[model samples]
Target chain A: GESVGLHLPTLSVQEGDNSIINCAYSNSASDYFIWYKQESGKGPQFIIDIRSNMDKRQGQRVTVLLNKTVKHLSLQIAATQPGDSAVYFCAENEGSSNTGKLIFGQGTTLQVKP
Target chain B: GAGVSQSPSNKVTEKGKDVELRCDPISGHTALYWYRQSLGQGLEFLIYFQGNSAPDKSGLPSDRFSAERTGGSVSTLTIQRTQQEDSAVYLCASSSMAGGSYEQYFGPGTRLTVT
Candidate 1:
């Protein structure tokens, strides 16, 4: 069985500040990880993804760091803005079936204060 | 290009009633997945479809839940005798099999409420 969980249920950050959301996964076999952002009344949008072979990947304003040793994943947002406020979720692909079914963490609500 | 789409964005039914939700995957996508999201909770895997092969229904929570993919494009998820606990947002996602690890595009989702 695989379980993905977040350290904090919510995170509040001042505008223009850096925000980091953490997650831990229990399955060692999980190889691929993804970060998603879900705004109110919308579906989860793909933010970024990282393979087990890689330790870190960066997007325009976000970065995902994977630590396989401890089975941990993190998403970092730079210069957070009000629009960046949303629930962030981390998901892992078990890779056993290859159907790309992902197990998602509960989620961390990131609130950006102006 | 259009993203994945789900019909009946909001559905309301009484308990003991049956409901069917629809999903239209992106054109040319080979994989489709159904997930349930409860209020303030994460996505729960429901069923998965790949091409014309037999679907992987390992995630279906109970016998009352079933889904089918027709002609490798559209999918329908049916729930029998719905309960109040069955209320949730049903999300559908699809991905192409390019390179074996494609990103899934999600639909707006169908909100099912059982009164």
Candidate 2:
């Protein structure tokens, strides 16, 4: 059974500090991976995504690193702020499937202290 | 310019009853997806519809769970004889198939409580 899991259930960081959330995936054939941020009472918002062909991808203030060898993924936030507090999830798309279904990992709740 | 929208932000139904959840995808989006998120849990794939093709329901938990997309626009997920374990937030997402993009925009999920 393919599964995605987070290494930590909760991460508390002081405001303006860098934060890193880790995820491990069981399936090596997953070609596309994404990081989503879900705020209270709101839907998950796309943060950053990386394809298997790429080792790292960066966005505005975030970065997603994919290590295909270890089947691990990570999301890094620079200068974390109070507004960055939310649950973060990592999802993978199986390479063999074209249906666009995603396998998600248990989320990591990020709490930013002021 | 609008994103995906779901009806009835919250739903409470008794066990053994049926409930229908609706989803409106973004305009011109050819792909729509349904997912379930339990408390403190990640999203679970439920069903997917692309254009006019047959929906991929492999992720549906059981026979009691079913969904349909009309005119390739809006979608409906219905649960029959719901159980307390069925309580969760149902999420809907839409993505444009153009250029083989896989980015999906999600809607505020409907929190379902089966009492």
Candidate 3:
């Protein structure tokens, strides 16, 4: 089981505002991390990923920050849009295991008010 | 299929009945996976398949749940004597290889409702 957990279960932000979601992971062996967005009645879509070697990675309007010392990871969305209203999940892939199995967090629901 | 595809977008069945969910992976994806999401919970890994080889079913909750991949393209997840607790959305994903943990495409998922 993955110790990855979100600090907030639900978040509400106004249109064009920034949204930040935080996560904590317990497994230090995990080398790969990913964030996914899931809409109602749909599967999760890959958003961004980061490796343990790096502290931050940016893609599109999203940024992922990893703090190995604190075992924390965060996803920051710049200018959060109404379409960004969905559940976001943080996942970890253990490098040592070499298995493709991903340990996923419960998820944080982001509700953007348009 | 261009991406992973699952059958019966939604299913409603009575308790004690059996159900089968299907998943069709991409053209050449060799690593297939099954997961279940209940309510507001995260996805729970159920099983993993690699080509025509054996599958890793350690994640299966019990023997009541079983899955099989045929000819390395399509797969089926069968549940026997289903209970109300089995109600949830079942998702399927496929990657390039079993060892490649990189980006995996997911299917729309099958929403199973047990009454």
Candidate 4:
């Protein structure tokens, strides 16, 4: 089963501040993980992805960290902007060779206070 | 098409009525997927079609829900004897299976409301 949040963790950061969204996955077999952003009325847009073999991966202004020991995944935004306010989702792929049957976690809404 | 597209952005139907939602994948994608997002349930995997074969249908909630992709391109999901529980945003996604990294491109989705 995927990770289900008992409560939607709220992350409120001022514009230009750094924001970190965390997720705890239950499947240790999960190796490929991706972070997606969904606006109010749109499908999720891929932000970044990281393979289990690496602990950290960086994108333009976002980063993904994989901690298999605790089965935790986290996304870090370098400098949060108003445009970054949206719901962030973490999707985990069981393995590298699977057909990409992803198990998604309950999303966390990032509110950037401008 | 430039990206995945779904027909009937929004649909409201009466209970026990039937409804069909359509999805047109990217021109060359060989793998297509269907997902459902209900009020409390996060996005859930409903079905998957690779090429013309669906190696997995384990995610479908009930026998009433069915999906198929024709010619490995366009696909449709039909709900029989619609119930209020079936109301949700049905999302369609596609990806190139041959490539090493599989990234699913998703459509805006069809919001179905059963009254």
Best by DockQ: 1
Alpha-carbon runs more than 4 Å astray in model 3: B98-101
lDDT of 3 by residue, A1-114 (tens): 557899999999999999999999999999989999999999999999888999999999999999999999999999999899999999987545756678889999999998
lDDT string, candidate 1, A1-114, tens digits: 679999999999999999999999999988889999999889999999999999999999999999999999999999999999999999988655577888899999999999
lDDT of 1 by residue, B1-115 (tens): 8999998999999999999999999999999999999999999999999888899899999999999999999999999999999999999999896897757889999999999
- TM-score of each model, in listed order: 0.98, 0.97, 0.95, 0.94
- TM-score of predicted structure 3: 0.95
Name the weakest run of 10 consecutive residues (lDDT summed) in model 3 chain A. A93-102
Q: Could you tell me how far off, in angstroms, the CA of residue A73 lies in candidate 3 after the best superposition? A: 0.9
> Any runs in candidate 1 off by more than 4 Å, and if so which?
none
What value does DockQ give for candidate 4? 0.62
User: Scoring model 2 with DockQ, what do you get?
Assistant: 0.78
Model 4 CA lDDT for position A41:
69
Candidate 4 per-residue C-alpha lDDT over B1-115 given as tens digits, one digit per residue, 9 for 90 to 100: 4999998899999999999999999999988889898753468989988875644788889999988788878999999999999999998988885645567888999999999
Q: Given candidate 1, what's the lDDT at residue A50?
A: 94
Ten contiguous residues with the weakest lDDT in model 1 chain B: B97-106
lDDT of 2 by residue, B23-95 (tens): 9999999999999999988999999998888889988999999999998899999999999999999999999
Query: Candidate 1 at B51: error in angstroms?
Result: 0.9
Instruction: Encode model 3's per-residue lDDT on B1-115: one tens digit a residue.
Output: 3778899999999999999999999888888899999999999989998777689898899899999999988999999999999999999998884454566778999999999
Top candidate, metric TM-score? 1
